[model samples]
Structures are given as C-alpha cells and as structure tokens.
Target: MLTKPKILVVEDEIIVAVNLGQKLKKLGYDLVGITSSGEEAIQKAEENHPDLVLMDINIEGNLDGIQTAELLRNRFQTPVIYLTAYADENTLNRAKRTQPLGYIVKPFESDQLRSSIEVALYKNELEHRNRKNEESLKSTLNQMESGIITTDENGLVLFCNPVAEKIAGLSYAESIGLSLTKILKLEDSTSSSYTLPLSDVLISNQTIEKNGIFAVDGIGNKTAVSIQISPILNTEGKSSGSITVLRLGESDNTNQSYLKEIHHRIKNNLTVISSLLSMNASNLKDQETLDIFKDSQHRIQAVALLHEVLYENHDLSSISFDLYVRKLTDLLFEVYKVDRSKFKLVLDIQTPKIPSEMGMNCALIINELLTNSFKHGFKGRESGSILIRFSLNDEQYFLEVKDDGVGLSDDTIAQTRNSGSLGLSLVDSFVKLLRGKLKLENENGCKVTLSFPTRHET
Candidate 1:
C-alpha cells in the first residue's frame, strides 16, 4: 500500500489554516499540522518531516512565508506551494524568488489545489532520483583504476576523476574549464608531436588506442602510458565531446625483479651440480665410464647456460638463440680440449629469441652431436670443420649440424638405428619430442638436419 503525501499548512488566519487542512485531508493528503506564523511552520515541518508545505506569503512572524520556505527547501529539501490572497506584481515577484512549486490566489477550488500538489510531488520525486543517479555515477568513476577525463566539444575539460588528476598533475578545480591539451601533456613515443589528435577522433567518431605513449607532467617528468580516446556521440550520430582513458604501459617492477632472482638461483644450483659431476669424472678408472660422466656434465652445463642468459637479460620470457649458441659451442670446445688450429667451428644462425624449453632441447641435441663427432668422427683425422646452421622459414624452425669428418660406417648406422649408441638415440628422441623430422646424410661428411613447426601443430 502507498503512504499518503504529508503536508503542513502555514496561514496567519486560524480560519483559513483550518479550511486548508480540511481540504488537504479530503484530497488524500495527510495534513501534519496547521500554523499561524512562519516560525511555527518551520518548527512543525521539522517535527513532522512533511513531504510538502502550503505556505502563506503574509504570515505573523519576523520571517515571512517566503523566507521560511526558502530555509525549509534549502535545509530539508522540502517542496513548498504558495497560498496567498494577493496577486499584486510586487508580491508575485517576491514569492517567485523562493521557487515555490505552485501559486494560487485566495479561495482556490479543491480541484485546482489537488492538481497543483500532485504535479509538485511528481516533479520533486523525479529531481530526487536524478540527483541520486548523478552521485552514484560520480562515485563509480572516482574508484576506477584507469584515469578518466571528459571534455566538451570545444575541448574544454568538463570533468576528470581523481586518477586523471594525478596523472595530469593537476587538481579537479584547476583543470575544469581549461583546455584538455593544457591539462594533459601527452607525447607520442613513435613521433615528435606533443599534441593529441582530438579533432580526428571527434570528426571520425571512433575510438583510437595508442601504446608506447608518454605522459609528461608540468616539470618534464615522463611516464610510459597507454591511452584510448573515444568520441561521445549525440542522438543524431554527431560528435558531442570525448572521453579519454589512461593506463600505465610498464608492468609491476617488483614482480619482474622476483622472476629474475628465481632464474639466477636456478642457474647457480645447476652450476653446482655440473661442478660435482666433473669432480666424480676425474676419479673414474674405465675410459668408457669417464666419457659417460663427461657427456652428462656437458648436458647439465647446457641447461645451466640458458638460465644464466635468462638471468642476465631484462626480459625473462625468452633468450637470444644466436647468442646462446655461441656461448654453448665455446664451452663445448673448451671441455673437449679441441685445438683451435685443427678444428674449425662455423655458425650461420638466423633464429631470434626462443622460449627456454625449446632452447634447452636444441642445446642438448647440439651437445650430443658435437660430442659424437669429437669422440669418433675425427679419430684418425688431423683437422676438420663443423657447421652449425639454424634458421626459420614458413613458420618452421630448421636446425642443421654438419661435420666434414669420415662418414658414418654402415655398422655404426645400424647400431644407431637399433639404439646401440646412446648419443644418436638420444638425438632421435629429442627430435621426436619437438614434433620434428630428422634426416641423416653422408655426401662429404656427416650432416644431420632437423625441422619442426614454430608452434605445436596437429
């Protein structure tokens, strides 16, 4: 059930006040109180908290009806309607200043009074709802993480949230009414222009996103930020204004530091294991067992080298494959004690940075193949050249390891196929893990070629 609209009556004459109260009750409005003075009306209004006030312009008090209505409206947001006997120009003008909801001459009809009160109540309710929605919108915008700023069609700042004020290095009071360009100093990282293309956005009526942009402050301090600007269109599809959003381009520095530290610790632990393997290999009596230990040590070092590269680079996602290969080959030559004058290492690497997991597999494959060549391929030769070529084409990676040494014997090839040789067998397994194809050739030497997709393919 709906509650009745509460009303208070203020008239200097006791008879008129009683008549007005009776008429309000008959109109389905709850008459809270009747008063003969402005002071009593205010006191009654405060006590009753009526929804509407029927105020008489001529009241017996230091404060007139107009003065009391203004105070009630301002303090309690109460709606007031004037009930007066005079309609003189002076009295009408004074009553209008109070912004009453309705005005009536003396001896008004019941229908007229009812219609006036209904319209006033409806209008006041609509205004109250609008104010609440506006406040809720403001609160939401203020809590957003990204900086938000709105401007008029002429580019003057209309409103900006707290985040926007912080990013622009200005307060809301100082920014309003100023040109958006003056408030926000944006510099394009790819260009030399310091101005934003707001006109283009307004004309095109489209949103534009920019990355690697710098937000410069008043004192020339620049922070990397990403920005998006969209035009606010009216009902006719014409640009009315614009809204801008700003976000920092750089990620959390603390998280990046933590990741680098983790990579560094992992590398250190692997190095310790590699050193322990070398120590045990020195005390081995059987040459075959010692070679096994050496191969394992080299494999461990290969993975450790990748982590070292990752720790040193600013980006922890991937490492430069070319640089990593260079370091790996150098370590292999030093470990095998190959004389630089007799053995030549040629590298034709064109691949860029690759993920750590893929890099580790490739490193192990290279280590095993090169170790095989050093142990048996050039056992009776005085000198030979090894070529390590890695390239990418058609969304696939190609890795080739070739050595100009005595070609593999028929028996050795049979043993490799039968898994008799652990080195070649391991290479085959690594190739299969990469979802790749491997080919062995013996034109002038031993050439091993492997091909795989850049990403996993079904």
Candidate 2:
C-alpha cells in the first residue's frame, strides 16, 4: 500500500512541461502540477505539497527557479533538482549555492531523474526517523523518578533529566552545558565534603555506588541521596561520558518522632496505673491483699519498662532482651527490698533481641519465675545464686532460669501443678500463649526451661 512519490514540474515551455509530466507518470511517480513561472511554481508547491520539485533554472519570473527552489527547500524541506540548459561554470557555481539535490541538463533521461528522486527520498526518511528516536529518548529520561545526568569526560553536563533538575533546584537549561561540580554539592553523612564519583568512573570505566551522601541543592536545601555512577562508553569501547543516577534516601525522622510520642503517652499511663495500685495497697490493712496488689503492680511495671525502652531505643520493633532482663531483675530486687549482695545473679543471654510483643511476654514470665524463686526457693536463706540464660537454636527460642536454693520435693511439685497456685498457673498459661513447652527440674535446685519456635509476625 505504498503511495507513489509526488513530483512538481516548473518549466516555461508548454511542450517540455507536458512531456515531463507524461514521463514522470510513466516512471511510476504522481504528477502534482505543472507551472511556467517561479511564483506559480511556489504556489503549486504550497498547495499540492509534492515530495520532489523539478525546477528549470531559467523560469518566467523575477525570482528565478533557483530562487523558488531555495524558498521551497527552506519552508517545506522538499528536495529539488535543477533542470537547465546552462551547464557553464558560472551557472553551476550559482546553482550549487541553492543546494539542489541533483543538477540535470536539458533533455535528461527518465532513469537519471528517478535515481536522483529515490536517493533524496530515502535520505529524508532516515533523518526523520533519527529525529523521532531522539525525541522519544528525551521523553523517557525526563519521566524517570530517579535523578539522571549525563556529562562529558571534561565534567561538563550534556543532559540532565527533569528529576535531576528538581533535585539540584536548577532548570535543565541552567544545568546543561555547565560544569557538574558547579551545579551540585555533595557531602557524606559524617560531614566530609567530596566531589561525585562520576569523574573517577570516567577514568576507570567502572561503576560506583555511594550511600548516605547528602545532596545540597542550589538553594542550600539538603536531602539524603544514594548515588550510582557508571561510565558511558562509545562504540569504540572507550569512555565518552559518565551517567550518574541519584536516588533519594529513606527518611526515618517522621517514624521515630511518631514512635516517641506514642511511647511517652503509654509510659505515662502505665506510671499512673502503678501509682493507683500502690495507693490501694497502702489503704489495705490485710497482708495478703497488699501482696496481691504489689504483684499486680510489678507485672504492670514489667510492661511499662518495655515502652520506656522502645522510646529510648533507635529501633522501635525490638529490644535487647539481655539488657532488659538485667534491668528488670534489678527492679524486682528493689521492689521486694531483697539484699542483691547476698544473692548473686548470673546472666548468659545469647538471644540479643526479640520482637517487642514477644519481649513483653518473656518479661512477665521472667518476673513470675524470679518472684517465685525469691519468695519460695530462697525463703529464710541469706546467700543464693540465680542464673538466667536465653538462646536460639534451630529456629527455637530457649529461656532457662536456675536457682541454687532449697529444691522442691516431688510431692510439692505435684501439688503446685495440680492445685491452682496462681504464680505457677500464670507461668503455665504464658507458655501455652507462646505455643511452647516448659519443664521444671529440682535435682540440685529449681531449674525452669521454656522452648518456643521463633514465629515471625505477619
């Protein structure tokens, strides 16, 4: 479905114009129109919009066919061939200035004209396709989210995408053709100033990635950005330019701020609840009721400490269970007024961290076990040692707490399990809540080991 190439004829002689039109049609070209004067030829060319113009150098107008062809070439980019009887040196020199596609003497053959037209049309189509591809490439670069810049080996900017321009706080027009260093300021997180790695990449032809780099824009506004620099190589496998991509870094400021607010509110609420419990215990004269209230307050304190740790920690998702266990045990000793100098505490915490949810549960379990050890095992005893060990093995989280004090008898253990001893019952419930198994041994002293799978939260 290819349309024939359209041709316009500009000749003063009527016979030559008619004969040329018939020759063009026979040669499989569409004849747009024929005109005798240069002015008429321009009018027909504008009206018909032919692909090729065959102009007689000597036409009937003040503006010769050469002048008209120059006008057509500038306005429409239409290829022209000079059809003239003059082949003298002076005439050729003037015709060359118009930049005609082909020069034809009078009485030219059909094959010569057809060959010239085909060559011109093919060259024009190629130029059009090249221009289209360049425009498409530019559009793609501008639409990208990551900042993209291409600079020559001399560090002069060649291309800067819209994202790159936005990051630098400079327009593309301002960035392009300028020194890349002049437009951008880069500094490391530790405040060390340096140029971008693009210059090095050009020299070594290697790729480099730099993280935690602060990008200071033209207006002195700063942003954290990670940059990647790679060399742009030519077809000869030599470094021609460098392409740098800048990706904005993650922002933790907002998340940390929000978590701090939440933890402050929660910690305050827990402190109020603990105070209310202590006040109620003071009002109660009965020793048993006061002990119960104190136990409840201790449990609340364990949870409250979690919020405090989360608020202070850089990471909000988990806490260092080792550090937390030490702190919690010290708090318990203070609560019970037990002399910590008499009872030595040994901790071998292999599990460095667990999720906050799991940490809270572990905290309560440890509290209950330690309370029981201090209350029952070390009763009437002045010197004792307690060991707390936490570890992870084969995806299993293990917690072991041992006490070197009065060991439990077989009958006493059975009674504690069977009877609803509140402390032991609560420990059992907590083990079940964690989907774990617990064991109690009283060979040398009371030793409790709890094992659970480290289940990841969805």
Alpha carbon lDDT at 75, candidate 1: 82
Model 2 alpha-carbon drift over 4 Å, by segment: 1-250, 409-412, 415-418, 456-458
Reference-based TM-score of each model? 0.50, 0.46
lDDT of 1 by residue, 1-458 (tens): 89999999889898888888889888899999998888888889889999999888888989988899989988888999998887789878887887788887788899999999999999889889999998998899999977899999998999899667656756677799998988899878664646788999999999998888877655355556789999999999999999999876666467657977798788789888988988998899999998888788888888888887665433455555666788899998898888878999998876645666777788789988898888888888889999999988898889999999887777665556565788888888888788888878886889988898879866
Best by lDDT: 1
Q: Write down the RMSD of all candidates, one decimal each.
A: 28.9, 30.8
Looking at model 2, the pairs that clash are none
Model 2 agreement with the true structure over 1-458: per-residue lDDT tens digits: 89998899999999998988998999999999999998888888889999889989888988888788889988887778888887678877888987777777778788987787788778767777997998999899988867898899888999988667646756667788888888878888787786876667888899999888887764355667889988989998889988889887768568767988898888889999999999888999999878889899998998888777666443566765765787899898898788878998988876656777778778788999899888888999988999999988998899999998887667656655564557777888788778888888895789888998889545
Give the Å error, residue 369, model 2.
Answer: 0.7
Give the best candidate by TM-score: 1
Relative to the true structure, candidate 1 reaches a TM of 0.50
Please give the CA lDDT of all the candidate structures.
0.83, 0.82
